[model samples]
Target: MSSNALDQFLNENLEDLRSKGLYNEIDVVESANGPVIKIGGKELINLSSNNYLGLATDELLKEVAINAINEWGVGAGAVRTINGTLDIHTQLEKTLAKFKGTEAAIAYQSGFNCNMAAISAVMDKNDAILSDELNHASIIDGCRLSKAKIIRVNHSDMDDLRKKAKEAKESGLYNKIMVITDGVFSMDGDIANLPGIIEIAEEFDLITYVDDAHGSGVTGKGAGTVKHFGLADKVDFQIGTLSKAIGVVGGYVAGKKNLIDWLKVRSRPFLFSTAVTPADAVAATKAIEILMSSTELNDRLWENGNYLKNGLKQLGFNIGESETPITPCIIGEEKTTQLFSKRLYEEGVYAKSIVFPTVPQGTGRVRNMPTAAHTKEMLDQAISIYEKVGKEMGLI
Candidate 1:
């Protein structure tokens, strides 16, 4: 093939992304990711990140990663099925199971891959998956890969979930039925009704899957949404990421030993991909230890969250209903939302705007992630910027 073919393919896709306004231009962070970050030679209060507990730059986690790197080289050599299952991997899985209050756990290279691996491993063409309309993209892809019949219920509408579950069960169109939802909806920060989901699952005998990517280290006093609702035992699969709050890279599925065992033997990712680095495994384990030691970080995180949320609401910005730290300043137009974020950035705040297809049209907004590391002064400054931007944009 001619080299022009590759160039043509790239140019066409790049043009399409630009036309859609979804071609995100990369911004270089000049300093460590934290409450305050240096970008474009300007220091700004960072409101766009997933480092909830601020452990991404924590000294403890750094030390653990360093020590682990010193002890065991860098990569894990091969797939877990071959020789990549290191002792640290097993230790991390055990620690995760204990942290999530589950009987067993399995780890994957990335949270995204965890969904790709676990969902396909258990459910297939003959299965039916009842998912929330707003579930994460990873979950949607996982369901598609499973070749299962996917039925989306209204966001947090337990009645719809129940009706669908009952219908799927009675129809006998599937060999198995499963319910999947995000423990915390990332966009709105609204928590899933796990208790209601469990009730429906029990009534319908459906498998329960909770993806707590945004909930872990932020809810349930740091354990996650399942623990928040005391459904750790009731939920069949408790999915989580080690990257966000755990300050490392990888994903996990916590559930009964049988489910994990089945995944270990069948999940293609685990069988084909190399395990996480020793440093990542050790750092994640250390992060979990910190979470288990006390709720101090979790409390501080919420404190910062509430402080920022209250300030934003008081500033007359239409922040939607959110029970978690993920706050969105609802600016209802795509261009306006993007402009609001740009204005805020110019004013020394680094919050990014999320627009259509990340969310429904006309519900675009700038999402703020307040971490435990944010000081009161930092939040106040952010509030001031929001007020100025809101006034300038006539969004107030």
Candidate 2:
């Protein structure tokens, strides 16, 4: 028999979650997660993927991945410091540096691992990290791991950030001060005020770090938030993911040569964890090439976002204030949000409900992620379905 104490604890916790309607019921996708996805044998207008450029199903990437498997096999075989670090790994890093317009770049197993690796690689208990209030969870975990003095500045509040930065610099308490934020605030799709944040960092001599996971293939014509604001040379640490927009499986940090060199020698994950597969590395490199070569996909993405946003607003739904393709239809109550999402799925759209504590209490929403691959016809049908469901649920 299983341990009685452990089983009781787990069962009690699960029951509590279920009673509070907090337990997430995951859906099984029966096919590729593209603009359209099949789930439970039913197709949907899938609006819940981070595949912003729709590169996950791109023929070029698949072909390159298959060829890479043929040439380099399935895995890297060992930790990077041991027998890994294949040629594709090096080439991918070089291409990423060029793509981000940085002096150098380093790769990691995942975006979360990149943060865990980079933050602690540079900081320690004696240092401080001034982070945005709404920065991603990975950032929070990284800061905690470093044992850094974390000062959370008000979200997107320049005055608050400036004040905190000044106080932290004058405290004479920490060895180093770093200002970290997401390039794009994931939930609301609001672009970070990088120009303002960077100016404060410069004044306080704080290291500037931007995690551009969501913004990499969605902003700055697919270059990212720093390049979007034309401050590529000013930021100290630029972290991004190969998984989301790149449609592969890894993460990276691009910065000055010294930082990259230091991370290579110092980051625990890089030394201990095995490198990404050859297929992932090469496919990520090719995706970067596509983004660097043209703006067609980027343009299409923006166009789809605008179309959907306008359609939602016209139908009387409160989409909140978003400047990116990530959209949210606020449904207020947690149960209401879940019901709305369930009804929407039954009606053919595959948008997902995000409730507390992914968001704050009573601010639950059905998030929509429109991609470059969605056609006009698909969007129009989705909009009509939203109208029908919104009326049935009295959301509109």
Candidate 3:
């Protein structure tokens, strides 16, 4: 009587997930997600957030957000195409272009939406996208929405990318070809070889896009991976997030003035969705300003990252070969990965396990994100707990 078909479908899917041990129970955070987090009244050392520079809890950002709320109120009231494009929004875009060393920029409600808007804005069924096998989910979705012919390139393999680029160009099956990659892959924390990618793009005349979500505040002295390699002008579409590292909520695309203008007119999300709150725009602007003004927070983040990576490696856990601070303590089976993370949680650490299909099967790992905010004392306690748990589970 009460939607029996929908109920059956949901019940079957839920049952299948549980039976396969793929179901996850979301935890409730009882406090701020800082270097440490409180959940179920237990304070645990937090290594899971993407808040790299600890800007989310910084006093300066908070004060600026509060001031913006007082001055501009909360909501943007409408989409950017209508009446939502405020002065602060324009300021944020200008500041972001400066940060990325680009001619202009445009903002979206969130990073995921930025992808959805930017990709579909320019690409269509006649176009093609050469994507990294390890690119983020948002990029994958964006490529799909574009209706472009998607060709997966091997991870960080310049030769493979080049071969595919040549093949795609010669196939004569597409109008425009865009090669997309994540500036810093989130799971392993390895940065994309932007220089290698740019060389190929130049040779093949491919539009280059880099999603610098993880790399923006964490790499290139807080500018990003594209700038890290000095290819800011060479790259085509530079996508970033206001949430991660910037410590607020929003997304943006920075590029040539013409491209941004096209996006402003054509990107569906920017056209349809309401703009971000004034507080978000101003707070993100302030955070970017802090990053541009100094590298103190960036230094701290790298130092903390190195400390965590060294501690885990010395303890004999197989933290994979990572170029950045992201550490993954591999524990093969899915159930073991989940159990290891649960023990870490109970032991005062709160790293989470990533399993298939987020990653390949039998390569399940408990990933760690050491931030600038984590003190030496907190890191030491976490490492000691890792040692205790590793021995208990015979993982070391």
Model 3, span 254-301: residue lDDT tens: 999999999989999998899999999999999999999999999999
Candidate closer to the true structure by lDDT (higher is better), 1 or 3: 3
Summed over model 3, clashes come to 0
Show model 1 residue runs off by greater than 4 Å. Answer: 1-20
> Per-residue alpha-carbon lDDT of model 2 for 1-396, expressed as tens digits?
899999999999999878877789999999998999999999999999999999999999999999999999999998888889999999999999999999999999999999999999999999999999899999999999999999999999999999999998899999999999999988889999999998999899999999999999999999999999999999999999999989998999999999999999999899999999999999999999999999999999999999999999999999989999999998888988899999999999999999888888999899999999999999999999999999998888
TM-score of each prediction: 0.97, 0.99, 0.99
Candidate 2, poorest ten consecutive residues by summed lDDT: 15-24
Model 1, position 328: C-alpha lDDT score: 87
Best by lDDT: 2
